[model samples]
Target: MAELIDVLLFAFLLATAFYVLLSRDLLAVVMVAGIYSLLSAGMFLVMDAADVAFTEAAVGAGVSTLLLLIALTATGRWEKPAGHRVVPLLVVLATGATLVYGTLDLPPIGKPDNPPQVHVAPHYLERSGEEIGIPNVVTSVLASYRGFDTLGEVVVVFTAGLGVFLLIGGPRRRRGGEK
Candidate 1:
């Protein structure tokens, strides 16, 4: 039953990812991108990572999509790629090849005995309560170990909002060729 559910979720994520990448219309692309985020959040939920799911649901499914739509309204719906260039394509292919090579060195999925999980998480779960005084390990990890990084993420988001508002929300500027 669990295996079946995992297969279905993976299929959904894959389909939505394809839709996001292959959609012709900008609005459709944006909608599919939002769906991709939602599917990712669902995957996180299934993996027992509630904290990650929460962030993905809020930021990926909600805030980022809204910001993208706002920017789309400010700019235009259609994207012009100018011209297809081989240099960028080659770079992308090289990077992707490197990533695929790196993945070969990773531990296989769902190994009964994974070294990192066995060694690291147990230690955190065991001593976190005594040192951090937090019963919830996830909350402690977020608020302590990566607290500053999280704060910086929020600051970056706020800055982007300010930028979009300044660029799009203000009075229209006179065109250069206006009489």
Candidate 2:
């Protein structure tokens, strides 16, 4: 059942990607992209990465979609027509192929003896209380054990949000009030 759900989710994600690529309506594409992110969050949840799923849902589906719609209000719903470009297509195909090939070397998921499971997770589970003084392993890892990495991730998210806001001509206001 879980395998079937995973397969369905992947199929939906692929469908959404194709929908975004083929559709000329930019608003529809953005909406579909948001759905894709929400679906991705669901996938992460299935993979037992609840924290990641939550972030994806909040940022990818919620904040991004809202910002895009706001941007669209300034720009328009339809995308400009473009002729087929072979180089970008070829580049994307090559990059995707390389990524797929690289993933071939990864350990099978959920294997007890997987490198992270064997080395890192155990240490966190064992020492999280003593070292981080946090009862919850996930909280301890994110807030204390991996604090620097988590802080960097937060910074990146913040920067990206700011960039998006700037791109959308954030808060256009007259001397008196907002336009």
| Top candidate (TM-score) | 2
lDDT tens digits, residues 62-126, model 2?
Answer: 99899899989999999888788898999999999999999999998889999989888998998
TM-score of 2: 0.84
lDDT for model 1, on a 0 to 1 scale?
0.83
lDDT of 1 by residue, 26-143 (tens): 7777877888888888888888888899889898989889979987897788766547778988998999999999999999976867887797678788889998998889888778
Stretches of candidate 1 exceeding 4 Å from the true structure? 110-115, 118-120, 146-148, 151-179
lDDT of 2: 0.91
**Under the 3 Å rule for N, CA and C atoms, how many clashes does model 2 have?**
0
Model 1, residue 2: distance off in Å is: 2.1
> What C-alpha lDDT do the candidate models reach, one value each?
0.83, 0.91
Listed in order, each prediction's TM-score against the native is 0.78, 0.84
lDDT of 2 at 71: 83
Candidate 2 lDDT trough over 10 residues, lowest sum: 170-179
